[model samples]
Target: MDAQAWDERYAASELVWSREPNRLVAAELADLPPGTAVDLGAGEGRNAIWLASHGWSATAVDFSQVALDKGARLAEGLDVTWVCADATTWQPPAPVDLVVVAYLQLPAADRRRAVRNAVTMLRPGGTFLLVAHDSTNLTEGTGGPQDPAVLMTAADVVDDLSGLDVEVVRAERVDRAVTTAEAHRGEDRRTARDCLVRVVRR
Candidate 1:
């Protein structure tokens, strides 16, 4: 979907996502010391707000101005900078300690650009973490984009960051609990297949 489509969604709903941080984000990063972070494609700033609340200075970037506006309103005293820009082309002015690319579904070429840019924006010894819908979710798991082209696997992330000077801490498919609301079912809890990648710059 494009920025306009996203804006329409945010405009229609008061909250497009939950207030809590992504499961993989909290699980993998909660233990790390606070530092500067960039939440690429940060829809509604959920992750960015959580990072700021946890002592990290965060910058949230998204193409949808509507989403950024909503996030800014929700992030009243937090240390978060909201930027309305495309993640694939918007380069951060300086390298940050952490860069998070979460659930930004796009075509392979576009996704490759965004992922490469994310790694490029990381400082030396900084970390680049990615959590996204796995391609297999369409058939094997529940609740995610139905299009295969928009979803990716852990190996895709490894290939996207192939030349980067980084240490892969974890890269694999993981399962996340899908609630009834997310699954569009009545009391049927399911698992969402997701790809998680955690890499530290060398």
Candidate 2:
């Protein structure tokens, strides 16, 4: 979807996504010491807000102003900067300790650009974490975007960040418990198969 379409979606609902951070983000980064971080394509700024509360200075960037506005309201006192800008084009003022791009679905080419953009803003020894609906999710999993071009895989992530000076911590597909809200859409739904990738800059 384009910027206008995303904005419309955000405006359609009081809140599109949950307020909590992604399960993968919390599970993987909870042990690491907090630092400067960016939540690229932060839909409603949930992850960014969560990071700020967890002692990280976070920035939430998205192309939808409606989402950013809701995020600002939800993050009254936290140390978070909300930026209504395209994730593939925007860059932080300086390199940060962590860069998180979660569930930002786009075409393969556009997704690679966004992932590379996030990776390029990471400082040496910093972390770049990403999670998305895996391509197989369309066929095997319960919920996610249906478009194959927008979905991702572990290998796709590895390829997207190629040539970057980074160590691949973990890159694979994993099952995530589908929320009750999501499961209501259909039957035989319990988990969402997603691509999880974590890397540390060298």
Candidate 3:
């Protein structure tokens, strides 16, 4: 979706995504030591806020100004830097210890470019975590983007980061509980979410 569309979506509701960090992200980085982190396409800054609260100096980047504004408001006193830029093209000011790429759906080519760019931002031995809706979510799972072009699998993500020394810390079709009102109105939806993939820059 374009920035305006996302802005409208965010404007229509108090929050598009939940206020909490993504379950996968929390599970993966829970034990890691705090450091400099960059959240790419960080909508509403849920993950960024959580990272900041946990002692990580986080920079949340999003294309939509409204989303950044909302994130900033939600982040009140948290140590988070909100930057408005397209993830597919934005480059961080410097390398970071950790880089996060959450559910930033886009066409295959764009997604690949974005992931590549994010990986490049990681410092040597830095960690890169990616959490995205698996492609099967539309067909076999409950709720997610209907466009197949934007959906991807863990293998697809690994392929996008092929050159990096990535370890499949957790890669499988895991079930995600959807509690959003729109999602819950129907049968309990169990969409597939990509698990953890820990990568170190070579």
lDDT of each: 0.93, 0.92, 0.85
What pairs collide in candidate 1? none
Candidate 2: regions farther than 4 A off: 181-189
Distance from true position, residue 76, model 3, in Å? Answer: 1.2
lDDT digits (tens) for residues 133-169 of candidate 1 = 9999999999889999999999998998888898999
Ranking by TM-score: 1, 2, 3
Top-TM-score candidate index: 1
Under the 3 Å rule for N, CA and C atoms, how many clashes does model 3 have? 0
Deviating ranges (above 4 Å) for candidate 1: 181-186
lDDT of 2 by residue, 53-80 (tens): 9999999999999999999999999999
lDDT of candidate 3 over 1-202, digit per residue (tens): 7899989988998899889999888988999899999999998999999999999999999988898999999999899999999898888788899989888888889989998898889888788888887888877776678998998887787788877665545555667776545554765445455434567776
Ranking of candidates on lDDT, top first: 1, 2, 3
Error (Å) of candidate 2 at residue 44 is 0.8
Instruction: Evaluate candidate 2 by giving its C-alpha RMSD to the native, one decimal.
Output: 2.1
Backbone clash count for every predicted candidate, in the order shown: 0, 0, 0
